[model samples]
Target: MADIVNLRMARKARARKLKEAEAEANRARFGRPKAERLKMERELERAARIHEGHRRETPGEEA
Candidate 1:
């Protein structure tokens, strides 16, 4: 015979587990330090500026 389980406790436990999983996911997603994120953003912006600087304009393609 299977042991009886309390439904309320089981439900609460499951909710706790799901909440923990979401928190873990959020930590991984947004875990970068502010300085590191800012540095990355600056590097990306510099790269974009360089890329745009190197672009050649076609005479007939003006929009």
Candidate 2:
């Protein structure tokens, strides 16, 4: 004889798995600390400013 599975139990198990996956995704998307994020933003801005400073202006280009 073959073994039988409960339909309700299987459905509940699937729902639990989906919920866990959603939670994991949410954590990954919002896991960084606010200070760390702000520091990264500041670093990017500083690098951009430095790059612009190093750019050479052409004689024909208008300021």
Candidate 3:
């Protein structure tokens, strides 16, 4: 004979597992160190500056 299980407890446990899995996935997708994020931002800013420097026509000036 199979052992009896509490339905409510089983349901709660399942929900907890699903939630934990989603949290793990979110962490992997978006978790980054502060220093790494800052470095990425700096690199993007530098690239943008270089791009703007190469442009002959400014946005406000008429050719």
**TM-scores for the candidates:** 0.53, 0.51, 0.54
Q: How many backbone overlaps does candidate 1 show?
A: 0
Candidate 3 TM-score, C-alpha based = 0.54
lDDT of 1 by residue, 1-63 (tens): 999999999999999999999999999668989988889889999998898788798457887
Q: What are the lDDT scores of the predictions, listed in order?
A: 0.91, 0.90, 0.94
Candidate 1 segments exceeding 4 Å error: 34-63
What candidate 2 gets wrong by more than 4 Å, as runs, is: 35-63
Error of 1 at 21 (Å): 0.1
For model 3, the stretches where C-alpha displacement exceeds 4 angstroms are 1-29
Q: What does candidate 3's lDDT look like per residue over 12-33, in tens digits?
A: 9999999999999999657988
lDDT (Cα, 0-100) at 41 in candidate 2: 85
